[model samples]
Target: MAQPPKGTYEVIHQPNKLKDLVGGPARMDERLIAKAEAALADAVSKIDLAETAKDSIVKLDEAVERLQAEGAEPAGPERTIYTVMHDLRSQGASFGYPMVEKIATSMNRYLELGEPGQRGHNDADAIKAHVDALKAVVATKMKGEAGAIGQQIVAGLYKISRTKSK
Candidate 1:
């Protein structure tokens, strides 16, 4: 496959050769385009939330390290990991993919009630899982079925975002 021009949107111009693996370009279908736009908006909104969660976790880890270094009792950030897990769970559901949504939900539940160390460990694992899920969804578009699959997936995602969970 030919590499897309720098800063250009045309990554794979041909429509018949399956340019993208997961779905086609957003322009191929109005519903897909709108869905993509909504997903992107949600991702942007969640970025700061995720970052804050990550920062809190990092601070907690640092605090633990410092306490260990000084032979003092460990005190970590409170509930940030759970909050992040919850947000990621909701986002996965909101973005479609029931499988990913399910995983996130499980992780969120773990974070919510697990022991402190368990929450921290699960937080990192959840982040990696969600990242991988997103990468898989965005990797490539389907060939002859691109338009149909794109429309279906986008519509499903939009429905999830608008009706399933808040």
Candidate 2:
């Protein structure tokens, strides 16, 4: 049966209309397709789980180095760093490292602050602080919301973010 919204369809299987719909036996049914999809999903999940997450942290560290090197250079390089920081901000929390995400978010804010005077210096020190924060979280294997130390670090970064560095 068709549902409302003009064009919505519910894909269902009707076994009785075997020879009429396709001129032969309906070889594929919803159950078969669903089972196949589930099996594929399971296989893909297994493959995805096999990769070591530590490698990701290593890569992120490398990216931080690149961002630091690009420090307050120009918009192009800074934009690349911004993209990296943005990704880290969104991905870290999902990967069980909320602290990294928090630090990344702060870094993103720092990056978005425009030029140096408006708190958007994008210097090595400012970038390093956030990157180091990420490394700390990963190394310590911290999970969930961070504790006082993390808060302190973030607060420090944010403080610098509000000031101009030129």
Most accurate candidate by lDDT: 2
lDDT of 2 by residue, 1-166 (tens): 7856777778888776656767866576899999998986676445421133455555555655655563434444456556766776666655556777777788778777674234333465777677677667767766667789878887888887667345
Model 1 RMSD, rounded to 1 decimal: 19.2
In TM-score terms, candidate 2 sits at 0.54
Show the lowest summed lDDT stretch of 10 residues, model 2. Answer: 44-53
lDDT scores in order:
0.44, 0.64
Index of the highest-TM-score prediction: 2
Residue 2 displacement (Å), model 2: 42
TM-score of each: 0.29, 0.54
